[model samples]
Target: MMRAFFNRIFGAKEPEPLPIAFGSIPGMLDEREAAARAMLKEQTRDPEQNIRNGIAQLQLIVNAIAGSEHDPEIHPKLKSIAKNTLPQYIRAMNTAMAKELPNDSEEFYPAAVECVKNCLNSIRGPGRYLQIVFPDEMKASRKGIDTIGREINAITVALGAYRKEMAALSDARSRYAAIISCSEDLAKAAEKNQRSRLRIDEMTGRLKEIGQEMAAMPSDPGMAQFTEMKSSLHQLTVQLEEKTRTYAALSMTASHVLRKAEKIATKQKHNDEIAFLKHAMALLSDHELPSCTELNTALAAACPVVERMIGADEIVLKNKEERAVFAETGRFCIDMVQICSDLHAQEDTCRIAHEALDAHPIHQKTGSLEREKVQLEAMLKKERQSQTELTEWQQKTQERIPVLRDELKNKMEGIIGRTVQYSDVFPESA
Candidate 1:
């Protein structure tokens, strides 16, 4: 009595919510579906048999219509019209009912509804004329239809709620599946983020070590020896350059005269000497250094052809540079051959010095460190960019998860008709 008095004064307390584990949502949906299906089976058990009996009643009505005799007082025109149309109506209704009914409720409901429609249509169609012919039989068929309709109405009402619950369960299951997939994706992203951070830290540490080593490298004793070797190589290179210019000036002057000789030789048909002059010019103009001994041999044979051509006055020297190099043929040949030998010797010396310096330990270590640092910096940048992208994706997915969770909660609540409180909380990280 005290409780009743208090209840009258205040609204009833809200019912306690059902507790659901987040991970068990799929299982819950399966259990709910099975329970709903069982409920449907219980409701429809008697209805199904009633529908079968109702179909049997319809079949008897059709057969009775086929054999029903017209009353003596009936109009001849009405009897004739019914006689013509009754067979078609009976055939159509039987065909509608004759179809094999599905065994499952989802399938059976529609089939039963269709059978009901066919039964009603048969009575409402041209079978209306049977009222006068077989009034008693027509009355019994309508009462049978009424029996089937009541059962159908009951099934319809149960199925409406059943279908709504199943639909909500289906929606909840789909939303839950999406949430699971997103969670897995988030876990994978977090794992990759962990690896990326480790790699970035590793690369940054290596870069720092390289910087420290490179900063202290200038004071190392081996650097002095490396510098000394570098200085020696530089001096050799400068001398080689100067010697190369001197050799080029001499070769150009000699080539200028040789060209004139070759043209004359072509006209004079001196094939042997033309070959010699062209081969010598090739040695001089070649981008790669020609063999110095081979060049000396070629020039030894080729310069005299230009000398004889000058002696015959068939070719004239064009400039003072050409005259100075080619006027005294014996002196010019001797000078050119000596300078070619000197150039070859200097090139060999410079090449050996360069190789020796490059092979030094300090030079190799410094170059290796520089290359590694560049590679590490590039890798670090790439990792950092991936970190940013992973963070952005995590943020968006974090926001989306809650929306999906709430939606799932609402859908599950609709399915069960009870507030659901999730037991398992989402993890902060993997």
Candidate 2:
């Protein structure tokens, strides 16, 4: 009955004792909390030491905000506020450090005591008394104003320099404009001279064309009239050549003269102007006729030479025509200064006849030889056409050959396999 009663009270198998790991008892946790509280009490015991350490920590916080060093102990909630308020705190600290301690005044002693009290109060709470304890916060508040003043000063200096630079640039631009104007004037003068040169070139080309035409005509009685025409053309050519040469020379001289005048006009400095004027006077007084007058005189002198050359050319042309006419007709009817001037004149007529024959187009087919040539060309064309067809057929045959070979190889393999199987079955019978 006693055993049953014990089992009823303690449970039928006495429950296994609850397992407990070492060092997990409630007393151990209570002892740890007590130790932590004692350490905190010890740290806060000396208020003066706490103040010093707090001040040092605050200095570190200020340094971190100022970008001088980092503070690991600063709370996250306070970090942003501390960063913004640190400059003011540092300024206050600096004011306190720089304060002149009053030696003879009782009022100053109370004020100093009150200042310490304010600092202690600030440390205990939200730190609003920090501003009252230190006066340098006013200086720090004016820092941005000081920066603005410095910026304004820098902007004024920069504006003055820029204005001076603008003046210099304007002067440079004026000088550049003068240079461009001078270049444009020079270009215009060059264009004028180039036009004159082109005119001269055209006249030269016309003279050469006339000369060629004169050389190409056949000499006949009708050619005697052309001989007079040729004489006129030769005189025209000589006159043109002389005039063109004169104009070209005059143009060159004029260009030089204009350039010298331009140089004199452009020289504005005193020494440069005096030198240019002296040079101009020397050029003007140089004892030669001006280029235009010299060219005119030269052209006038060439006129008589041109006429004499034309007369000589006319006489030669007339004599050549008369000789040619006589050679062709076997009679000399026209009156000429010389009739038999050249013995080869007859050979020249024969050569001209041969050239005419070579240049003439064929009118009638010549004999059976033409028919044979036509037949031969037709036969050759047919042969070439047959060759082209044969080449195409050969290309097609070559393409088909590879496919046929592949088919033959497959048929041979099947036949060999079937024959081998039949031979295996019939070996004993054979």
Candidate 3:
């Protein structure tokens, strides 16, 4: 009776538990396995597409975190998470994708599955606070969250201001560095100009000396040699004069450029240093507490000092230019003396050559015909020797000219390059 009652209560259709023989349902497990295999095959075949979809989703999360407004209904709870927490979620997602996507086996599948699970969990769990904080339900309590958000916004605004102040300070420092470089370059150029001027003066002095010696040569036995010496001296004097003029022009140009650079440096040192200090003060005030009036006073004080430095630099530049001019004048005089000396030496050589020719027996012969033949032979020999000497001198001069010119050109180019590199004459605005 109890068994019948139990059967009736439970439903006598306690159908004999379906026969549980493995072979009886032959294809059941196999179908399940096949279905799973087919699903896996589909996923494997389009891995690139899956990865692209994942990356797109990641970008969406990143964009939302970066401050994109989202529909509260669509993202529900994500909106309530702290602004900093979104970055953490992104990092976790990236880690999971990296671990999961490369392997075909189940090992990585769990990581991918976990990534999705955790993301959903995060939105439903602690991230629910985000929904409460930023809810679509107008009736939800949001006063506290709004107040905190406002405070954070104010802090961010302050930080932005501080960054601007710091940037100004950096700019000021760069200006100062440029100014200092220009000043140093100007000083060096001034020195070089002075040296060049001095050299020109020395050359001029030597030329004058040569001119005096040439004028003193008399028509004596050695007079022919003196004449040749005079001619050579004249040529050297002309060359020295030309070089002196060129160096003088170069000195002027250098002096001008140097002065300009010095002026620019002075201006920069005066203005930029103060600007840097002001910027630093601004940064300090932003980070700490400082009065605006104090910054204004500091800037005012800096301006006059900068102007004074600029004036001083201008004075220095002027002095340097004058000194260079004076030195070059002196060099011109020295070159004149050198020209005289060179002429004297050339004259002496000519005299020796003439004397040797005169000492030959050809010139002393008494018989007209015999003398003529001897004179002719002597003259021919002298001509041949002269031609050889001239050819040697010409070759040596040609080789020397090109080498010297190239050296001069290279030196000039180096100077120009350095000047451009170190000078702040160019405007920074461009």
Candidate 4:
């Protein structure tokens, strides 16, 4: 009957023990083997089925005690069990129930405990009151189980949202890291470009100085000065070439940095840093390496003209000072010449007076006047010789002035890089 009851409750699919092979033994004691098989079957009890049997027995005992409530001591014992033992049993069951539920499962007992406590408080007079409150306690337990289910579902949903938020935050942090690294690279690149620009400026200044010196050289290349100027120019050209190569490399690097910056700008659209990078890149592109090359090349091409101008300026300055001195000397010579002519006339007068005095020496005593005329004659000869030397010097200088002027005009034309024309030499003069 017990076996039939277990089969009916637990079903045919429940595990069964293997039958004992009593026939395989040669000289088996049938009675002893049957006893051993029975003992083995009795020892192998199913825990769930046993628990069900125990619960059924407890229900039967409670029902029997309730039916025999005329007994006085049984009611107190049942009350003690309700107050302590049942709660402990529920706790043990909850521990077992946790194995089936999630780790973060909600509390199942509070609502049930509260409900039972409230129901028990309402029924205070007698021990039989629990029997009356049992239905309400069961209802509260069911409600508490529903609350646990709902709370578990809610917690599961919230955890999902939290995970998603964490993922988004991680993505944002990654982008920030990329931006920081990219920005640092750009800063280094910009600094490199700035250094290159400074080098280019220094080299350009040196080239310009060389060009100016070359311009100031004599137009004749065979001159010792021109030879030295050409040597200096060669050195400057070498330096400029090196600087140009360095500038080209820097420009390539700048271009690379700009490309990266553009990508960053797209990635971080609406960012202020990207806007600044764009502006700086535009400025770099507009005013950089190629402009330097163009300016230097232009300066080099115009060097010859500048040289001719420099030579012409020197000639004009030197000739101008020379012409002024010649004019003053010529004026002094003219005055001396006039004085010499007057002296010659006085000398003639002195000679004639002397001859006259020789004739009238005896008649008229003019010895002091004759001595004065001899001194005047000697002074007149010296004055005429000095005037003649001054006149020759003045004439030579006056003759060279036109040659100097022509040379100045030729030099000026060379500077103009055209035929000799007044307008060409000085456009403003024209």
Candidate 5:
């Protein structure tokens, strides 16, 4: 039961038996014939059918040695016999059977007989001595026999490749004939493209002539009239722009005076505000009731009056209205200019006072907040240090529990003299 449980946990073990190798002569011949017959069946079905029946028999003899079923130590010797030694004998046999010996080589037939005999010595079967004749051939000339076999194999390969190439050439000729049959259609398309090209050239020439005529034609009378009117409109636009600038400057000056009077009234204390308003009323009275009517009229009037008031700067040609405002009584314009200057100067003083007020509050609050932030950061650093120490202590405690459990399991196993289940000692770890 313990052995079975061990097997269940670690998986079963079994040894593999070796495969058998062929050594009996009858068994070798039987395998050779079977392989040859199988190869012949497939060769007959192939379209090219180039594998000769004689070659298939030779291939079977080669397989008897080169095949993977032999022992490793004997395999190399068997491979040399099948691939090199026997091929020489097979070539001589085939050549003699075909009766293709050279006229000058009388000893070639004797050599063929001797090579066959040597090969038969290795392959003993039912009918071997009768198939090949043992002749009185030179033992020293075996190398020449081997050379002849290699040359024969090369020639056979070349002949097969040549035949395949010939078949491919025949297929290519058929495709060429198919292409020749479509030549008339291709010629017709070429002729159509040529006609389209000629038409396009003719249209292109006509379009060039039309473009020349258009460039030569005179300008229209209506367009000339439009050019003249545009020039006159541009002059009027310049005069209107000048009048607009002059009017804007006059309005800006008047508004500046009113703005100054309003700003002077902005006092920090209630008493200061009352006192400034009283002073403004007294100044308005000093300008007198007559000057007030003129100021009010100029302020409320149209663009032309404002233009006339500004045009008085050039005294060479002034209208009666410009003279009454700028020359006879220039107080309103002078007073407006003075007030604009005073207000511009006061803006700088107000900016400085406002900056001082804004800085006071930020400086007071930031110092207090900065001190509190420093204390909190220091506290956070101390807490993180404590947390790190606690985490390391907990890890060390957890590590020892595993080692203690392992020690207990070892003691129990020694006492019982058998394997201990890990689940019996620590169910959670299991």
Candidate 6:
């Protein structure tokens, strides 16, 4: 008695579940599903057939209710109510029975349940009113609905475990497929990471070699001349900068006075004077040094405008620099002309020196190696970035594989009714 009471309390102690492997899950799941389907068909066959026969009995009862005549002695009110409600109950029952139940277990289960519920509702809802008038028909209809309900209940009880097993089997299939796909992706990512590492090493080593070669490059025959030209270019650049600065200061001051002359000329409608003043100011304000001849010509025309403005008191020189520059406009023009000429000559010399240096093997080789070094550094950075992303993916994938394996193991244990030991090797975690 105690043993039976304990057994009733806990049901039966389940046996240990069977073991499976990560790789064999698909084939095993397929075999289990096929067996379950065959079992479902066998178990559901009699119940489904009974449900159909019960439905036929229910439909016949519904038709009998439709065609049966009411008693002439019955109360007028009850007869009128039955006349109205009888057709409604018949249509409801017929509509419920109209559904053609499918043969598949998955589809047949719900469809059978729906028919049972609908038939029961029709009997409970409208048949209650007609019970007195059509007593035999209503009683038969209720019995038919009960018969169908019982068969549907039997199907439900029989498939409860099958549904749970199918669900577990389906879950195992998904987990196993995901594990396989994850393994493939992890492998491809690892291969790409390896290639990236190799390429990065190659570029890194090449960069080192380039650095060594640049440092140990032998002296060339024209190196002496190249050094001399480089020094000459630097000196010319310095001299030209000084000359340009001096010329800018003087020209800006003179330009201020010239602008006043231009405004006055505009008011007086002296187009020629305005043009001369604007042309000279443009040359001084230009980013590049104007030709010496261009400066001489522009100043020759424009200086007279500033001098005339000073003579006519149309402009006032505020600063000492302005006064000095405008006070001796002829000397200023001469100095500007010499400065621009020297700048042009120096720039030409610098240009020729730059060309010679660029054409030399040492400079050309050095520039090429430096450019190559920069390119290799960029490629190495990109490779490192790719490697980092791949490493992160591999880590996440490696972590996920074990989790999926554990879940699949649990699901397989549930489905197969045993403690499932996965017999497959897994990739190591990062």
The best candidate by TM-score is 6
Which pairs, if any, clash in model 5? Answer: none
* lDDT tens digits by residue: candidate 4, 84-181: 54444344433333232112212222332343343233223232334432544434433443444444344445444444444444443343344334
TM-score to native of every candidate shown: 0.76, 0.21, 0.23, 0.19, 0.23, 0.85
* Residue pairs with backbone overlap in model 4: none
Task: Tell me the whole-model lDDT of each prediction, alpha carbons only.
Answer: 0.85, 0.39, 0.44, 0.41, 0.40, 0.85
Better of 1 and 6 by lDDT: 1
For model 1 the TM-score comes to 0.76
Alpha-carbon deviation at 219 in model 2, angstroms: 5.3
- Runs in model 5 with CA error above 4 Å? 1-55, 62-228, 251-430
Cα error of candidate 3 at position 75, Å? 20
Q: List the residue pairs that clash in candidate 6.
A: 16-418, 17-417, 17-418, 17-419, 18-418
Give candidate 1 misplaced runs (Cα > 4 Å). Answer: 1-31, 58-99, 110-157, 180-188, 311-313, 416-426
Cα lDDT tens digits for candidate 3, 404-426? 33342333233222211122232
Q: Where is model 4 poorest over a 10-residue stretch in terms of lDDT?
A: 421-430
Give candidate 3's TM-score. Answer: 0.23
Ranking by lDDT: 1, 6, 3, 4, 5, 2
lDDT of 1 by residue, 229-332 (tens): 99999999999899889888888878878888899999999999999999999888776667768887898899889889888889888789988988787787
lDDT of 6 at 59: 82
Candidate 2 local distance difference test against the native: 0.39
Better by lDDT, candidate 4 or 3 = 3
